[model samples]
Target: MSITARLLRYFAFFWILFLCAGTIYQYINFKHDTYFIHLKQTAVATGWYLPAFYCHIFGSSIILLAGFFQFSKTVYNNRPLHKALGKLYVFGVLFFAAPGAYVMTLFINRGGFVFASFFIQNTLWVIFTLSAFLLVKNGKIDAHVKMMHRSYALAFGAVMLRFYIWLFMRLGIGVDFENNYIIISFLSWVPNLILVELINRYNKCPYRTLQN
Candidate 1:
């Protein structure tokens, strides 16, 4: 790797580590604190909340950080490790995180718009993951890469949500909390997809846009 590429890679590595560390800390804090911090009273009323919450939090944190190492060329060349990580990622999302998100969506902060944004985000997250898995199974490496890139972008939404919240707080920009969250619901993932699109275009992957 060139110097600039190495620098960018290190930056991305640390950034992902930061997000993963924050996620772990938040989950650990939630475990000891007792009640739901972000959920509405209605969601808390549901007995399924904690189980689903843990599933998404723990599973997503693993999936998010797993991507950082999985993308390494060295790891990719190591068939066993690559395959193992891929299976773990698929299991975490399909069986735990994605289902948890689907259930949790029913209880998001009030307003149809907020719910819908999150609904789409989680739905796409699952779809992208499955698509990546299926593509790789069929030996479509390029298509799989395209799909996985999209999946990671959505997975990173959890991290982006917190960043935006902190950014707003640091700016001392006061807005209705509910409205702000609703905006963040969409903002976190949409820009990520747009960014991936720009990368796909410039990088000129073997299968640009994953078209056959």
Candidate 2:
């Protein structure tokens, strides 16, 4: 890896760890009203929201950590371990994380656009992840790798959403919280997927030529 790629890898690793740690600490008490939950008391009252919230939080955390290592040369060389982690990541997203996110989207009241953004994001997340699993099952390794990259790009949106929120706040770009959230809702995942596409193009990923 080039120095820049190495640096980005380290940065991403530490950033994910930091976010996961914060999420764990925030919900360690399992309280009904806490952090973001505190803002969604109405949603919490629905009885379904809290369970879905926990599912998304805990499930996404596992997949986030596991998926990050999916790109590691060391882990990739260890076929058994890589396959194990891939299974964990796929099942975690399909069964727990993505489904939970889908449920949560129904409760979003941040206007139709914001809701649309999240709904679309969750939908694509499932599609990409499922495609990755199916492609690998069919022994299409290159396509599987491409799809996995797309899947994790959306997965990383959880991190990017929070990062952008913090960044916007610090930069004083969007003072209105509601409008700011609306912007970040799309910003979080769109750029991630676009960047992944650009990277695949630069690397001449086989999936691109296959599509062409």
Candidate 3:
């Protein structure tokens, strides 16, 4: 593998480890946490928040685990297993994960443009994930792959959210982390989508854009 690819693989591995572990731990703790419970109780948005919250915790944990497998040379070549897991991944996002994310985004305590920006991104994540699924169903191979990659990038934003927050604190800009999150919200997936485009460009693959 090229040096860049090797470094990216290492980065992906560490991110999966860090975020997956944190998500699993936080979720298990959330099951008994009065803080989360109280937030659910006092918040008017529990209807979607609770489900989305758990979905994020559990679904993301599952995705982060499954993500490693998706890139595996063994599984990637095994179409049946790949398709099966991909279906599960997509289902988790469409019905459980992405929808829940949208709900939670609505209840973000940091009300303002940050909320608006996140909500917008959350909505796009849903659309992107669903569009990917439908493209696959319609037998649009290239589009399906591109859209799915975009969806996963948005899903991976959950990890980047934490990454930027930590970066902010390390830089002693803790108070401005909210602003940092807003920037990350847009940037996290945008670059991923752009990378997908670059990949397609390099491979000379034809894809159907959302405009199409």
Leading candidate by lDDT:
2
lDDT for position 35 in model 2: 65
Model 2, 35-118: lDDT tens digits are: 678889999988999889899999999999999998887787778888899999999999999999988999988789899999
What root-mean-square deviation over C-alphas does model 1 reach?
Answer: 3.6
lDDT of 3 by residue, 97-206 (tens): 76777777767676576777667666777787789778777778677767766777777777767777777788887735456666755666667667766865676443
Between candidates 1 and 3, the one scoring higher on lDDT is 1
Each prediction's Cα lDDT score?
0.79, 0.87, 0.70
**What ranking emerges by lDDT with the best candidate at the front?**
2, 1, 3
Indicate whether candidate 1 or candidate 2 has the larger TM-score.
Answer: 2
Model 2 clash pairs are none
Off by over 4 Å in 2: 174-178, 204-212
All candidates: TM-score: 0.85, 0.92, 0.82
Q: Give the candidate number with the greatest TM-score.
A: 2
Candidate 1: 10-residue stretch with minimal lDDT = 203-212
